[model samples]
Target chain A: MAVAADGRAAVAQTAVAAESRAVSSNEIIAEFVDVHRHYKMGDNVVRALNGVSMKVSKGDYLTIMGRSGSGKSTMLNLLGCLDRPTRGEYRVGGRDVSKLDDDALSNVRGHEIGFIFQSFNLIPQLTVLENLEVPLFYQGRVGAESREKAEYLADRVGLGQRLAHKPLELSGGQQQRVAIARALMNDPLFLLADEATGNLDSNTEAEILDLFDDLRPDGVTIVMVTHNPTVAQRADRTLWLKDGEVEKLVTNADRADAAPTEESL
Target chain B: MIRDTWRIVRLGLKSLMLHKLRSALTTAGILFGVASVIAMLAVGEGAKQDALERFQDMGVTNLIARSKKPAETATSNSQSLWSALSYGLLYAEADLIQASLPTSVVARVREAKRPMIRGEHFHTSIIVGTEPSFLELTNMQVREGRWLGDIDDRRLANVCVLGATLTRLLFPLENPMDQTVLIGDDDRYRVVGVLSEQGRTAGAGSTPYDECMFIPLHTHQRRFGDVNTTRSGGSFSRERVELAEVKVKMPSSEDVAAGAQVIRDLLAQRIEETGDVLVTVPLELLKQEEESKRMFNIVLAVIASISLLVGGIGIMNVMLATVTERTREIGIRRALGAKKKHVVQQFLVEAGVLSALGGVVGVTLGVGLPFLITTWFAQKTIILPQHVMLAFSISAAVGVVFGLYPAWRAANMDPVEALRHE
Candidate 1:
């Protein structure tokens, strides 16, 4: 029933998530159906995301865009599993997770989600390799193999030689790269990026987008929220929100068929 | 589980290292609290030991009766003073004390005033005439040669044992063994033994036994004749005294109280109208000291607890501020899939490590302070391992207890709001 707005992501759904009977979807890893969130300010209830619905599929590079008071932040928060829906159903891995308790929700967040922030919120005291191991740390995966994986991710992010350096010692672009590598630590179902390039220069922003493109072949799905049109154009589809509802889901038709572009920085 | 704890602890340490000066300053409160606990207890223990040794030297199971002149005799008739003024323990009284407690050992004593000369060295000192049992009753050890025996008393021998101090004065450059010391113009004695130094028997002054010259009772009675005469301002006065004191040592500590009561009853009339015929029981003194020491220890424990309480408060204050300052970090950790319990664990470990570091340093200082106190103040100090352990464990507990509120506050923060914190 929540498949109309983004049909490509909700393609093979056969059962309702709200009824506790989610049908198999090889593509859809996360879905939000008729979600509503409200904040009480004095005597009035203010609706943040009024009946918003969306779906994110495997290997799908999707971006969310909207103006102020458009429920953009609410969607980003819900997609990251940082907040559960006040009403309606949100599911991950064919399981309804909106009603899960704090501990179970924490487990889901730990094992199934990865988050990247615009400001690159790396713990300032930890070395680059240690920061890359944080998500696995919560999953009790902090051992010899985790170290090797961290090293590999550091090299993948072009930070191999700077593994022992703290975030404060790195440039803003390099720190953001480290944050991206850290987000990939647990091999989450999808990467949730909140204005992932909002703080970087245009040249560095292009480099990060290229890195996302490089990871797409490995079946790494990405869902980014941003206001920049150029950044939104890089994703396969951009969901635009207005007044807490889907204004439109614009497909970047050219991205599906174009070869990887080599942009000199 | 151990590995996880080790990782979190390492993380906490790294976080604390970010603000080294602040962490160290916060730790100071606990350090001094622990140090003062151990050091103060050591000093108190040392003082108790000093008192215990003195009471032991006084012989806890022994009773001492000393003779003092009657107070009314200070202004006796001037004409009567010229005849004879003798008011003290007579030889008969010494016999009474011995017969009263048959199982006890009794030592009778008489003091004589005279000047002794040994070649060029001349010293004026008190001569103590006592039985052979005096050495055992008073706990004095002879340093050289043998003490006076039964044969010397029977033969009225002119042999004497010099007190430790007197031996030094009379024979500075030669051995005093078998040396002749003239007691006055008319009497001389051969030194049989020299005594070992007796530390302050009671308090802050040298022992009276150190300066005394001991002679056999039979010899003292025959030579001095019980009458001492003095001539001054063309007037002469004579005082006759038979015995100075009687020290009685009971067979066991249990016999002391009853024995003391017996002496009190027998000497009741002799003690009338004067502070003379005074009796001293060291066991009673020892009991009284134990009671006072227990009270003193309670007071010390209270003071130590107050110091630690204040130290715990200091830790809480610093931790609260730290949680507030690092709200952003807490949010970031939470966003990265950290649970509330994990956040709590991190901060708790930080607080524990901080105070435990202080405890370690405090134990070192506490153990060292007693040595410094012993050397500088010339007082004994004892450090018990249990005391060290108690202080250390309490300090660590203080940190955890005090850290609880701050850590809970950090863990329960709204992650979205915290992430927005500037």
Candidate 2:
């Protein structure tokens, strides 16, 4: 299955090589050129993504929306550098990461991208302060400066007073806030959130969405993958995927006019 | 880098702390292994030292020639008559040995079981008749007064040197030196000196010297005849041995083997058919004992290491389970920018810590067991510092060796799939 995916990604990579030459490195935080991902299940090849091309500019608040098996997860994995695209060129902070090895990808993931999970994946064993220092710890940069930065990020996420608490000790909203604080601790180039508010109640979800909105104006590029249309409506633009292909790319004005409602379901 | 390692170690410790009972049980395996290694080595060392000391007491440079009645010849019916058997080391043999090995100190000994009396007190002990050279050859020390001198031997004086135990039994409360002790039924001898305690045993085939009294060779020959007769089961057996033993000391340790061979050849030439004389070299016995000790230690080490092997397997089993249980944690670490090396380091350090802990506890137990054995069992146990370190190091290495597979499994987990795991 991985081999098939790699073949598809390789094909997509050459298709975008010429276009990538025209794109300026300084203005773009992330770019996916003709990206493809496929999985082989028994006798069938399940295409997760096909020739998906996009660019994430600085300060962009982008949302990827899709139903189950709509390539949203695969796109998140590729964008987060957790896994390489099978055949596409993925440039993060203007560096081609699609062909990089696991270690180099890990370096990019550590310094260039921050991940926020719906489950708030804060290490239960560590306190809030330690969780915020993990990225720096990986970079071998843990010291007084990292501690001060953690403190500041915790305060920015409204978790300044809960710095010593374990993740399980906090409410869902508070844990998500801690996760957000951790994501910002490394001064990453962009934030990749997977179902960022999916585990929270509506009110807590709204609070987290508001936190994301606040971070956007401050030039913190966020690329969120979620299925909820209501969540997608709040982004500057939403990329809709269906059957491993781009169904639509809905901008802010287009979303305001459409305003997905109960009738649409 | 040091700080990072410290953090990883702390993290490893925290994970191990989660399963306190399991971790401790695993540690116990190594603990017992290390303890057994130390205990066995200690026992071996103590036994070796004891044997060495006993051999040393007999004097490593000294060679002993003793008279033994040939088993085949003892069955002869003529042996029942007094003065019928005339076998064993002769006076001429001693003289020949001394003449041939001029650089060696030769002491001729004649032993007789005689009843000793001091006033009203009476005790039976072996009376050893030896020259002054016997003192140096046998490494015997004088505690008080003086040993039997050349004047005593030349004049046939009735002066004796009492063994430590004999002095205690004969004197009880009075000073033994210058005191008179009666031997057999009528002969009286003056105690000129006392020998320091030489313990109960020496090397192989040597008599326990602490319970015997020493007198001049000439005096012993004049007082007691060369023939000794004993009646057993209504039958009287008689044997005539001019010299019971001949102790020959070489000038240096290196000359001992050659000197012993020369003495053996001379004795063989005289009584080649009887085979009634036995030559014992403490140095030879010491070497044999050392060889056997090495074999014993190797067997002991093998047994102890098997326990350590079991302990290492226990660590591996627990670590593999830990890796499985912490799959999600590993994924999280990888997402946070932990390289595969970091993941490997974490688990390896965890295993290292577990074994090191076991090593430490085992050392404590190992060191303590010898002391307990020495105190309660009354067995000598010497714990060498090097052995303790060796056992501890082996345990730690076992941990690393056993931990590698599980650590590799953890490090090789696909981050995406791992994160998806429940």
Candidate 3:
């Protein structure tokens, strides 16, 4: 009872199977496909990112490793919806992101994705508590809910006693922790960390990583970009990028711990 | 939205508070501009009232009819400086008008003089003759004794009414009412009445009511013997009479025009030449003065408005600088989901509030200055009408016109770019 199948039909069957894998897991919270970000500087065309594609899943702590000019920050910008891809189909939670307008992208950043910068981009004039409430202010979700959420985050970030203090009054680690608490205030779908531990000491970096570890099991997806191998090793998966495109993708087990005091790659 | 605006306003206020000196300097321009407009307007109004009151002191609604010199007549003789040739209103003419009209009052006036009379115990005195009705004509009131009457005129009596200044000169220490004073040869005149003090008319020196004597008109005609006229011709051809004044009375201000028209018509019918009578009506002059005062007030208001406009420009300048200084703040507000309209409104309200406060101060100054000027100086008071809402309203308008540019700049900031700004 052998029925010979046509070559075209067999090829089509494999194509469907590959297409299934494209959206295989509802776990794929965000996807970047052949994204290019080109910027014009005077007469020269600077390719900030050259056709980079990667996927991040729910509860996945992924690290993006690259040198200074390797477009790691640009990748984080694309993920955080702070910037749009020059060309490519970028999707977040099964929604096509190329079509999203600037305001919509901001909304997504404000609601769906939270960002933490190494510089601790907290408004220096505002108190630590007020800094945590900033993203909520932009979300137009003011009142008791936002206040309670800010209070809870202040406690979680170990800045409960320093809530009334301004960013300038806090140390590097404290300010970065305040920024992290601010980023998590809206219960965002993913946390996009851009060199979050770059300015922190080893002990403070380990503490921040431990905070992230506490957040990951709560179903908060994390995508961290860093040049430090020690920071990258804390992630569940590592994507080593060179000149924008992914050179290799490895698991946390494959990324051996580098010297704690070693210089950032 | 209100909460956001409140925050922004608080921030703006904080920044302004930070640079207290600069803000005060900026506000100083507005203060000076506002205060100047108010003070200038008040002074202008006071000056106008001073001029008006001077006119009022002369007379409110009285008519003055004076005689003009005849066109054909000329005074070639140098001895006729005190007396002038007249071809118009005569003594008989005044009598004629009085007898015919059913008016409120009438008075006959004539001029006469006597040789200088000196008593053994007194100094030299100058005497002039006029009728008893002259007391009423000059709006005079006797301070001490009785005025000359009909019996005095009928008997050709030499009873006299002395002015307050003249009484002080003739009698010195004695009561002059019953005393006899010598005039010319073999003639003695009895003093009758002393008039109340008559003040000076607007810029005119030596009011006639101050030092003149009043006698019967008949006595004057006889005493002078037709020598009052400065004749330059043969006996039958010489023009007669010097100066004679006529006063026309009306029932009310509304009837002034009617009274004037009647007098004009009557004079036109009686006189052969039109220029014989130079008629002056106080009511008409008063109206013309009022119209000119209105024009003066408008000019003053326009000048004052320039200061207000300058104040408005000051507000605009401050607001524009504020927009530039708070560009980052504006950017932050825009990135925080504030619409362009919201941003513009916030700035506009801030500017409006600033100017409105300035306006309030200006209005107080405008109203307060006049009272202060009057209290400090012996001057006529200025009156501001209910329609002076322009003081505050114009300042507010200035705020709007000047504030628009800065507000528009603030509202038009791009959120994406603004959020990226440091």
Best by TM-score: 2
Q: Which stretches of candidate 1 lie over 4 Å from their true place?
A: A1-27, A256-265, B1-4, B69-79, B83-100, B202-207, B225-242, B254-273, B294-305
TM-score of 2: 0.92
- Compared with the true structure, all predictions reach lDDT values of 0.84, 0.86, 0.68
lDDT of 3 by residue, B259-348 (tens): 677677778843455467767777687778778878877887787777777777777888888877677656544433345666677678
Per-model DockQ = 0.49, 0.60, 0.08
lDDT score, candidate 2: 0.86
Clashing pairs in 2: A9-A86, A9-A87, A9-A88, A10-A87
Backbone clashes (count) for model 1: 0
- Candidate 3: TM-score? 0.63
Model 1: per-residue Cα lDDT over B352-379, one tens digit each? 9888888999899999999999999998
Question: Would you list the clashing residue pairs of candidate 1?
Answer: none
On residues B138-208, what C-alpha lDDT tens digit does candidate 2 reach at each position? 88889998988899999999999898988888899999989999987779899899999988485223447
TM-score between model 1 and native: 0.86
Sort by DockQ, top down from the best: 2, 1, 3
Worst 10 residues of 1 chain B by lDDT: B199-208
Q: What is the lDDT of residue B263 in candidate 2?
A: 86
Q: Who wins the DockQ comparison?
A: 2
- RMSD, candidate 3, Å: 12.3
TM-score for the A chain of candidate 2: 0.85
Docking class of 3: incorrect
